[model samples]
Target chain A: MHKIALIFGHNDYTFEIEKNIKSHYKKIYIFNLDGQSVSKDSNGYEIEAFDLSEDWDELRDSVNIDECEAFCILEDMSKNIFLTLSLRETFKNLKIVALSQDKESTDKLILAGASKILPTTQTTANIIVEMLKKPMITEVLHNILYEKSNVKIAQIIVKNAQYFDGLFASDINWSKDYNITLLSVIDENGDTEFIYSAKAKHQQIKNGYQFVVVGFERDIIEFEKLIGGADE
Target chain B: MLKSLLLDAAYKINTSKNYTKTKHFFYNLLENSNYKYKKVFDFFMIALIFSSVFILIREVKSHVNDELLFYNNYVVSVIFLIEYLLRFWISGSITEVIIKQSEHDVMFGAEFNLSLALRDIFYQKIRYIISVKAIIDLLAILPFFHELRLLRLFILFRVFKLFRYAKSIQVFTSVVAAKKFEFLTLFIFASIVVFVSSVLIYVMEANNPASPINTLFEAVYWSVVTISTVGYGDITPITEAGRVVAIFVIIAGIAVFSFTTSLIVTAFTEKLDEIKDTKLIDDIAKKREFYLICGYENISKEVAKKLVQNSEVIILEEDEQKAIQAKKDGFFALHYDPGSIESYRKLRINIETQVKAILCLSHSDVENVYTALTVRSFNKDVFILSILKAKANRNKLLFAGVNELLYEKELVGMIAKEFVGKPVAFEAIHALRSNYNGIDMQEIIINERIIESFKAVADLECHKHRIILLGIYKKNKRNFYFNPTYDTSLEVGDYLLLIGNMQFIKEFTDNLHKGK
Candidate 1:
């Protein structure tokens, strides 16, 4: 898959997002709100100025719409929402990720058709800071976020409840036998809970239920194979 | 030897449980604003003072009813007498002074002179008795001594007792009292002007037959009336020389009066801001448990918004505008220097006991670090959470005693990278963390009752409640156990981390409380 990342706006957040996801994309184009008419090169990536008023015809001409994903991260919140709405309108199936300033803007960006809204708010920061107070959870989250560690978080859908042999979810020795930690379970109704939670403990493995697990990629793959393929 | 025995008996009585309890009860009723019944007592005393003074005022015009006069002259006087005696009693502990002096004499192996201790104690009592408040209290009870015609005049002092009940009047008096030097200068200047002008007027106008000012006393009164700008036409100067002296006196009067007015106005203006800040601090201190936010930045504002709905939150910002803005936004905020430790002390934040957490969320990394450090200095165990605005300042924040750090840029970048390809996972994580989709992550603790009701994690029935429990945090080990066996028994003091819709979480916790 030749993945292309179309990032809108240039600011502090734009740089970090581009830098981190640069390797995943075949080509990355940064649409600068203040860019000159001609395309400029910034750190080996192309930065082209584009007007929000334009119909985005130049964007479609420059990149393959099917293979590209849009990032709406304009510093101004209203502009970010406008860009998300424009991108969603032009490309019916484009995966648009938006950076929202707060809860109110998050709702606005969602209504503007952002596929995923990443809240950049002190409230979110406060929640994260609180979670990081736990030493083990902090290390686990840090590994998943910053480092290029082999540890990965993946979701597996249950295809056969018979695999558990009528035993409860807690009956399975996940980490001991499969070397994969069962983080949480999401039912067909989309209600998710930690596998170890009091409510999830005695639950029978039901078909179509998704299990979120964290482990090395090799272990996750092996565990998925043993449990049968996902719902798809 | 007899003196020591007598002193020992007096100390015993002073320290007796009954005596101390009676004294404490009266002290709280009369003086302690924090006492539950203090307001009631103040109201009763104020009403009594007003009625008594009203009776006295009415007595001058017409004869008051005999019954009303009897109550005011006898009952009101008795109450005032009791109040005065209580005030004098709680003013100072004489027995404490004598015992302390005796202890000192023993420590130094010196001769204990009973007379010296007595003299020192006498001065302490005399100081309290001669105080302005004490004098008013004494005069307020003089209606009982109406037999002495002169003492009957002191009944008007009952009105001054109103000053004790009204807090605003006391505050105004204190503010004015703080400008003692300025008031003293004005007094001296006015006295010199009055003397010089009165001497000149008496020498010039006392001989004028058409003038109202004949006696030296009348000339002195005329000069005072003119300098005060009252300008009573009855005391006009007839002589040309006398009129000139009056002109100079009038100009001096304006200067002196204006100076006095400005002095008081300046004092009030200077103290008003301080008074406001102190009041805010006092209001915050009343909260048994509150979150103390160090700054009113965007993040802290968000934090305060979420917490303020369910709990008390106080925002301390160094910038006056930001603090005022926070206040306008309907949060408890005070203009205080967050970076300075004095701000915490000024707020009287009992970090370990009262404050649930201290959040240092200033826009600047330096400010957050300094605030965290200041808070940490006051309490070693207070949970200090700070925002690391820049990546380079992580170590500095950690070293400055921030227990938890939220690096906004790093988290945003990482989340963006992680979810760009997987939309489902992105939505799930976002829902779990932020209010983007109304789902949130919360922690619930298991107590003895919860342990008793549900022996194992499976018994919680989180699935039925539609809430997800992620793991159990063991209290003793301070470690989280993820994906425990279904039969994993719960124990008291274990924290369960759950992720679900807030409504579902509420229902789940409510069910747990119901022990279902």
Candidate 2:
């Protein structure tokens, strides 16, 4: 049961960001700093409004900043940096994530002691939107966010393995034996080749190959032991 | 020892690299009609056939010089004989390459052994030699055998070879083949009408004293002439019953003629349209890479205009006027609803394997999202880039697996900010956005091969090439290094931002790939 604090200026993106992430948190405290005359409640969720230039100590006390996860989504880069610096000063381990309008501000946000920075670029948004469109991507995202599944991606290097030394990719029963999906292979030349590609199907597996596999953690461990190498 | 030495020499000739290269060249020229030199060969062959026909006709009509005609016939026959032999030699390799290069297993079925492969190649060669084209080629040289008077008739077969040069004739034949059932139905109906009319007239006129149709054959001939509206008048109906039957037959003849003509006309138009569509799809599919823009709005038009100079662009606009305008402006525009699967099917989206990206530039965010979803459903791996107007719709589009998203408001705000504070930087950005004197900025990924070939940044010689290396974005560190030092070495996944003239950039990229 994690409590979250969302700080936003009067921007259309804030509402969308808040709506998408609200379900993951137990309690959400939205602080609107634009001081616009708007509804205090959004679908039974309360929004607290404040002035642009405000006393940080008073706001921190009111929001119980130390006990909550904070999201800084200010529209202006400088303001977002200022808010992040202030939050970092107040609590060293607050786990503050800030939004940046561009690449240059992203560096500033990191320097301001934000635990994470999300660049509000259309490219980033599009990628996320695209992933949400696919059910498989949604399932993966849900699993990662909620810790609902043990499936993880692991890159394992191949050492001396007699069975796999000279066998084509199609000849190997990776999923049946190890419960792993062989996504790709990185050869000795550091070129990544998709396992299912026509060029890769005839490729003979050899030593010094790095395999990127997706499977349960225990199965990955078992596969690593069988291949005589640790996860990269 | 002499036999073994000769066998060794034969093996060397068979396995030599130059021999294989020559074989490949001849195979391409003879078998692959799409080959560049093959067109020239086809034109030459057509010219030769026409000249031979003219000479043959002249010999038949006028008192041409016997020696000149004989010499012309001999030279053309020899050329045809050589071409026939070359085609036969290359047919085996052509069959082998087709089997080896087909991407789908459905075409060739399971792989066969070496002996079976050889047998298949032999069968293919036999089939080719017995084909209509081969018969014509053989007939074109038959007149040279002057001793055989019967073979003189075979010389006319050169006219059949003209079908090879007429692509429309092949298309028309295929259309007729496909509509054979409809044609048979019309033929049966017309035959029934003629037979019934002939029988009725024969019955009515046989017993009439004043009837000219005394025999059934003469009555049938009269019906045939009247039904065709030719009215030969060699036979005529005399009685009232015969006259009434003739009137009905004439009316039926006109109706059936018009119906048959309209049917043929409609079928031809439909078949031609279908052929055009298939040819367009085939041409687009053959392209290795192209950009598919979903809308023909102002932004999309600008994007198409910019990309048209160096890259292939296809626009799918639902608005008929816009699509027509786009075509008028020299862009390939297809009027299709982007959201519908049927439209995608018509476009043969699934078969277009080399589509580099689909850009959804619709004004509505929802429409863009729908287009992205539809395209992704058809092809899971194609990169989808969409322009989003509203921030609220970002999550939906991101979930749809759009690889690139351009926010209109964000871009506008950034440009505005730059314009107010840094005018020079703004101008530079503006210049890069639109082509300024053929100069523009392009971002290229540094792949593993590039990293290995060029160990240091200085080796690229951007200065000598008149190109500027703006910055390098290191993927691993997620850091942008502006104006990297000459000693700095690039890594795999680094993006090199370069500014140069289009031609120079193309050459530089080519040279980089060539490891020059």
Candidate 3:
């Protein structure tokens, strides 16, 4: 039930981050540096207008800066770095999370005394949002994230399997017969390739090859019994 | 002859079996006929209606021949009357099916009351006479009753009956029907504007010496003409009050006209989009052979370019701009999500039907797998060629039922590997892959008909066809013979890999089929 403070620049990424992590905190405060009005109740969070160019006395006096968790997500790198420096100077015990627009900004934010730095160059939130849009991906992610799933991703090595050698990747119906997803394979040369991929499609399954599979723990054990393990 | 024909018709109607057959025939003709029969009937009806209209138009002229007009009208009216009678006769009662039962059946025995049956027939006949189509048919024949001058106007309703026959008119009417409320609003607004303007003009110009609008009717006409921006100079308002009113009317006219026009345009464009979507789906379903290319990227574009020469290519691209560009490049492109099963359903993909092969060329391996899985679920036999970007998702895709897998990294690696040791070989491979304007390689399947006319590789007359016999793929043996000997006997199920000019290769393949 800790209070959190979000410092924003004029961009959608700040709003997105606020939306994603809003449920974890008890009281959330969003400060728009450009003096632009941010909707309070729309995102189920409290919003305030503040200018980064001003002194920190007013901000520190307005909010309980000593106990609050701060996040600097300004669109401008310099502005974000300055805000982090100002926040770090005012509240020595405050945990400051700053967003870096690039590699240089990442180094600068670290030097500016941010407790943690999140690099926005790769934009992981966009990837997550996009992945969540697909129903299958959402189910897989939901199982991995929220549910205590029995499914385990395991890499099994093939040994003394006469029926499987020289068989094409497409020839096997792993899901239908064995209830397992054959993810990829590692060859005798220790080079891993996707079985259905062009690189591994022509590669014959030798005795020392390993297959990375995803399935229930019981199914993997059963599959291991059918195709002899790499230890044997 | 006439008396004998009448007696034969009466005797046929009295016979139950013949009556049943006649009823069935008329029912088919009127309601549930086949495509050709329905088309013939519609055309005949449309032609009759138009000819009646033409006769009506001709009757308006002063120098028309009265005798010929009367004869034509009489003949057309009799044909219409006969059609109406047939339609009415076939409009049997609900109990007609029960009445058709054999007399041996106790429910409809020989002792069944004939008076009840007669009453049902009379009731059905009365219902038919009151029906819309029957009334139209009656009106069509009404012009023949020239004794009643008032009934002559009913013939004009035949033109409106044409609305039922034409599909475009039906669509138009439905669109109007859907937007009737909006149209009513506009009509009310326009009526108020016209009324107020007429009243204002009458007040302003009634006593003015220079005003030409004298009567209330003239004022109303002048107001309408001026507001519609079709002002006739004969009825100009010279007074200052009249000029101001004219200005306001003109501005209101422009606003209302543009508003109504935009409303209609919006409705029309929406209808057009609906029609285009339906037509595109219909076209895809009707095509006997076509390739469904998922993802309109660079690789798929190249694949489409190669296939477009000898086949139809339907592209489903998620990117709207790319799909539009693909369409501009002369490919049938649909801006739809490839991973969605709904889009595949819209394309009507079926086994051994419209689609020959599906190329899943999306950059994302997961997306390709999903598309392949959806398509394979619907059609098990269709050739699903997917490109694998990530090596990790390969087996999952294969398990998902992709038929052919093209490894992107492996292809690039192979080419790079060959570049060091065999530069000349690499160049030849590159040339073939590029598929430059002049020389092209095509794979032609040898069917039963082609095998009958086939001889040795030398007797194919490749030189005459401006083609070089590259190799032959033996189907049964599953082996490729590169540059076979002249005496190699051609067999059925052999794939002829020939390299030649694009035009000649097409001609040679076409001739090979024709020679069968």
Candidate 4:
């Protein structure tokens, strides 16, 4: 099981991230770079004060380093860059998700050895605003992203291709038969494309190709069984 | 009967298509800086001014051929004359003034006063004639009369016409003109000092034959030279009284010069922001369609960057620091209060027509609402989108003329709520929403062509295209049918929400366009 660590510095998003992912992780640690001393937040998560200059030995002692993912999201972009650099220097292979303010900083964080960079400026709010223009699309995205509805997005690796043999990837009416939207396909070579993309449409369905589908939990489960595969 | 017939004929001519088109053509050529063709005409005028001035300068040193002189004397002058007339014609509409006056008279049951109407038209033309630009334009044509020496000297005024073509020069002159009151006071003071000093110096040194200052004219010259600190030793004061007067004059000269310098400096400094704002507006107006974003906070900064790829995005920021930051970030930003009507009015943006949309993205809901109302009052039909910070103020923003709003906190919270035990799903959804890996949700509107091309949902063959048909947003019902059935017949005005790679969607749309 993967553990989660949130290192925050005067940012508002850390609490929201922690609140949403709390139940998923067996052990979750909250570290505050801005404050001195330790205290429990309103959510009862203990906040441990941290310094960028440190080697992060205390963090390693509490959580299994190999099974942990860290999020670096400081509102001050310069400080966030420094923290990411420090964390990368301490843990060479750790998965670090860093929040970037803009394009320049996104490149900087990537260079700083962040495993993943979540750009705050370019992606979220702006895309949300664009989606809001179409109220129906916004509702669909809202449900798929946040709401606890039965609808979900899953990636299934096909272990058996008997049902899809001798058929092009687009030949199956997955939505009509299985009540699931087959979004994309990842071949054994790890090439991914939209299922209806010209290149994907011409390719024949084969075993070991991963399919990304979106639908209700029941429909996804039934489709997974029919495809002789499980979630990847 | 003749009077009514003449009035009807005049009104018909005033509203005629050809007549208005001609007026609009000239108006764009002479007045509308935003008009695309205006630049070409301005360049032509500038080239003419340069060539005419060059010929006049050339003639001063050496003899020119009659052919060259003829073109300079007649061709350039004729063009200038035509331009002057066009400018005067467009300066104010005489027909509008007459129509408004007649309408007022009719409403009040007053007798139509032909004399009063003529007087109004006379004053209107006279106002345009007396303007500094008009005077310069009128004088620029005088050079055509090469036979008259006095008129030839007026050709130098043609160089001043450059101000009419170059906007920066106009801005500089307007900045100086803003301090007209201060300069007027200084001018009166300096004149009085010169009058007194010239008289005093003349009375003190004229009787001394040894002194060079003899006549009042010479005394006036001496006073001007001394007060201006030119200090030519030839106009020296031999008597002690004259020396003392000279000393006082020099000191007063320093005071006057310093005051004038400080006044001009202050005026430029005060008008600096206004000049920049005007330039920004002109730049955006040149583009013709732009998103006017209010506030320069993080949300606005991000939105502006994204929107700039597709259209021009201008940010109106009230805070000086934020405005500067926005400019540094490569955005066109005006350091003007977004909540004030004066800011929009001064910008002269035709919100009803040119602005694509207005986005109020300030952190404070109150500020956003105020900005929305200010923009809405300017044009009731402008699409205003605001970011609502507080959920409680949603109705407040809606009431203030926000056509649509994005509640960033609520949206973020929703996304955050889904991170538990569904990390992959959350990631997949976020990735798709952000168009990561080229997957996105696109809305296609069913119009007449689309309806005819695709008779039913089955005809789209969305599965064959590999795009996910999320649902149809029925236009008539204003309702969404999730996972619509294949047999659902297509209808005009409905929106189909599909999720797929942008390339695939483009292919789908292209095929639909081709009626394949």
Q: Between candidates 1 and 3, name the one with more favorable TM-score.
A: 1
By TM-score, the candidates rank as 4, 1, 2, 3
Of the two candidates 3 and 4, the one with more favorable TM-score, higher being better, is: 4
In candidate 4, what are the lDDT values of residues B1-516, reduced to their tens digit? 654554566577789999899999999888988889999999999999898888889999899999878888899999999999888888877666666667778999986555676688899899999999999999889877556977888888999999999988998789889999999999998888899999999999999988888999998998888877778877789999999999989999998889988998999999987776677778767667788889988878778777787778878999999999999999988888989999877777778777878888888999998998888776799888888777789999999999877765444434544433444455556667678778878888888887777988999988777788977888678676667788998788888998888888899988877785
After superposing candidate 2, which stretches have Cα over 4 Å from the reference? A1-232, B1-33, B81-147, B188-256, B278-299, B309-312, B316-330, B335-516
> How well is each residue in A1-232 modelled by candidate 4, as lDDT tens digits?
4656554553467665666666667777777884865577787877778877878788778777888877787777888899999988988888787777678999999999988766655655566457445556776666655644456777788877878767876777877888788777778886776666678878888898888777788888888998876653
**Which lDDT tens digits does candidate 1 get at residues B1-516?**
877796797689777999899989989898866566888999999999889888888988898999998899899999899889888888878777778778889899987668888898899899999999899988888779765768778887988988899888987998888898889889999999999998999999888788888888897899889888888878889999999998899999999879988998999998898767667765765688887888887777777877786788888889989998999999988888978877777777778878888888888999998888877776789888887878889999999998888777667787787775443444445445544445656777888777778889779876566555556778688666664566899988888877666777888888787885
Best by lDDT: 4
Q: Is candidate 1 or candidate 2 better by TM-score?
A: 1
DockQ of each: 0.22, 0.02, 0.01, 0.24
Candidate with top DockQ is 4
What residue pairs clash in candidate 1, if any at all?
Answer: A170-B486, A193-B468, A194-B469, A198-B457, A199-B462
Q: Residue A124 of model 4: what lDDT?
A: 54
lDDT score for residue A22 of model 1: 79
Tell me the lDDT of model 3 at A10.
39
Highest TM-score scorer = 4
Q: How would the candidate models be sorted by lDDT, starting from the highest?
A: 4, 1, 2, 3
lDDT of 2 by residue, A79-195 (tens): 889888877876888877677766678898999998866655532333333332332333342342223555555667788657676887645655545666565566788665555
The sequence of per-residue lDDT tens digits that candidate 3 reaches over residues B403-505 is 7676543333222223222333233333432444344556777788887787777667765564555457676775656446667898887878665567778
